[model samples]
Target: MGEIYVDGARCQGHARCWALAPETFEIDEEGYGKVIPGRENSGDELNVRKAIRNCPERAILERSDDEAPAKNEEVATS
Candidate 1:
């Protein structure tokens, strides 16, 4: 399975990630990105990667299999 992470401090609230994958990402009350739970991986690896790449601030992050967690991030959404 895969995991989603976001660097809230780096997030500019551009909403690009949310726009690309509404089912997986949303804007929190504070305007930060909030990822939907239980659907982090869900086999939508390509879409997840797209969302990550689409992040304007490059705040979106992904971890798969045995890969180490990316740097300077948190589980802001999931």
Candidate 2:
């Protein structure tokens, strides 16, 4: 599982992260970023990276375990 974190103070209710990866994140009714329960450490590299890149506030962060990070594999451009 990959670790993901949301800096609540930095979130601006943009919901970009949710839009990018609905399976991984959601915006609360109060307009702050919240990680969907049990998704904090999901190994969905593609979706997680997409959310991080799409978040306008840059509030999202990822952490990998002690193991070496994954090598870059080609992903098709949308």
Candidate 3:
């Protein structure tokens, strides 16, 4: 599986990533890109990669396989 990361500080609010992969990415009201909560890699890899590549500020990141956490793992809630 693949995991995606977003650099909020570097985001330019272009909405390109969100536009390309709405299922995997979401844009805040301010227009910054976010990897949909708990869905960093739930969508197609090609689509995610496209979002990453299309990020103008290079704020998007991705890690694959062993480097990424499993999607089914339980999340600890406070």
**Model 2 TM-score, all chains together:** 0.69
In the range 1-78, model 3's lDDT, one tens digit per residue, is: 456778788998998988888888888898888888878655357887787778899988766556566544535332
- Rank by lDDT (best first): 3, 2, 1
Supply the TM-score for candidate 3.
0.70
Model 3 alpha-carbon drift over 4 Å, by segment:
42-44, 63-78
Best by lDDT: 3
CA-RMSD of model 3? 4.5
The lDDT, on a scale of 0 to 1, for candidate 3 is 0.77
**How accurate locally, in lDDT, is each candidate?**
0.72, 0.75, 0.77
In order of appearance, the predictions have TM-scores of: 0.65, 0.69, 0.70
Q: Which has the higher TM-score value, candidate number 2 or candidate number 3? A: 3
User: Residue 43: error of model 2 in Å?
Assistant: 5.7
Candidate 1 local lDDT, 1-78, one digit each (tens)? 457767687898888878887778878877789677766664356676788878889897666545645443456544
Q: lDDT tens digits, residues 1-78, model 2?
A: 456778787899988888878888888888778789778876366887888888888888665454323433223332
Q: Which is better, 1 or 2, measured by TM-score?
A: 2
**Candidate 1 lowest-lDDT run of ten:** 68-77
> Which 10-residue window in model 3 sums to the lowest lDDT?
69-78
Stretches > 4 Å off in candidate 1: 42-44, 63-78
